[model samples]
Target: MAKIGFIGMGNMGKAILQGALKEFPKTDFVFCAKTEATKLRVHEKTGIDYADSNAECANRCKYLILAIKPQFYEEVLNAVRYMLTPDHVIISLAPGRTIDQLKLNLGNDKRIVRVMPNTPAMIGEGMTGISCRKEEFTDEELDVLTRIFSSCGKAEYIEERLMDAVVCASGSSPAFVYMFIEALADGAVRCGMPRKQAYIFAAQAVKGAASMVLETGEHPGVLKDQVCSPAGTTIAGVAALEETGFRNAVLKGCEAVYKKCIEI
Candidate 1:
């Protein structure tokens, strides 16, 4: 059986498949795009074969990634469901579409893996949250998914009940991070740094700070304290951020995302 079959060849789907190929070069992969032009373009770029349709992809692969948008899930699932066997595992990437929801479409006995992966996956630095019943997947099946995701970046398995929080925390948070970087770069540009250089400096600094948290295993507040020696420049900036309710704003934004996720 084919290792993975992708239903969409969009950015996330392509990125993830590329990552998996790098790690599991011998594994077979097939994908189906909505248009012949897209299929040809992705084939030329990736050197991966394409299926004639979504159902063909499902029939040929043991694991299927439903990478299309949430709005199209009903249609695609309906089209492909009859082709799926009990041996096939469906991996879903859409937020708010819970395992229960997918089971309602594909039947409760169908094996489903729900994951929330973000835009950073395009760069092999993404964070993904995966959820599936432990007993539903064999060790080999779980390992395959782990390798596919960890080849790109970090992967964590969490309970499905908390999947919506994963949407707010990582799935949709890349846009928030990008906006933060842009604002930081703009502030630096206002302070006389060249625009391009400001972006590099701001982005690298954010990256370094994140690495420090992960590498040092220190609490984020403690890390902030380390940079905030009495009345220091960093402390001054931190004070300004606190004064402007920066943390509150980020919290509110996440709250909004959480609300929208559950609504869908």
Candidate 2:
């Protein structure tokens, strides 16, 4: 019998599978894809097992990851409801779905965990936010779930109320970061750098800068000051960013994402 089963094999689902496989090499995993093409693709790529249907997947695993889109949650959960037992834990990756809503579809006493994980998980550097009631899960069960998340990157348990914020901060922020990298590369190209080389330079600089923040344990402002010498070129660039209201723009973008997540 599989220890865990996933109900989707999309990008995020595949990323989570890659991570979990590394952490649980001895554990059997099964996934139920919507089509035979995807089912064959996932199994061939990852060497993991596949189930013919959602109910079959649910029946074979103790932990079922509901990785399908929010729109399909009702159908998927309804299909698997009769197979779910009290011992099963439902780990949901849909953004707007809540534990309570899941219980209404599955069972009132069902254990559920809602999580937000980003695309970076494809590279084993994902940031995931998880929410679960302490009483709903045993300590060992929680640890296994957390380890599955951490295998890709970082995982933190947060209050369900803050899940929307997590969506804004990490779930949707990778797109914004990619935009910034593209803009930086464009600027370099404008200054006579080769287009391909420009992207490498911009991407590495962003990666290194982010590493410093995680490793230094200092305020970002202080780190900025460290880079900006008196009347230096860095200060000139900082002035331009300030004049363009870069920080405000990012904050407003996050606010917009948070608003949209709540709507969903």
lDDT of model 2 at residue 200? 100
Report the C-alpha displacement of residue 141, candidate 1, in angstroms: 0.6
TM-score to true structure, per model? 0.98, 0.97
Q: Candidate 2 at residue 98, lDDT?
A: 81
Question: What tens digits encode model 1's per-residue C-alpha lDDT throughout 1-264?
Answer: 677899998889987887888887534888999999999998888788889999999998998999998888888999999998778889999988888888888988899999888878888999999999979889999999999888778999999999999988888788888999999999999999999999999999999999999999999999989988897899999989999999999899899999999898
Give the range of the ten consecutive residues with the poorest summed lDDT in model 2: 21-30
Clashes of each: 0, 0
The segments of candidate 2 whose C-alpha lies over 4 angstroms from its true place after superposition are none
lDDT of 2 by residue, 159-181 (tens): 99999999999999999999999
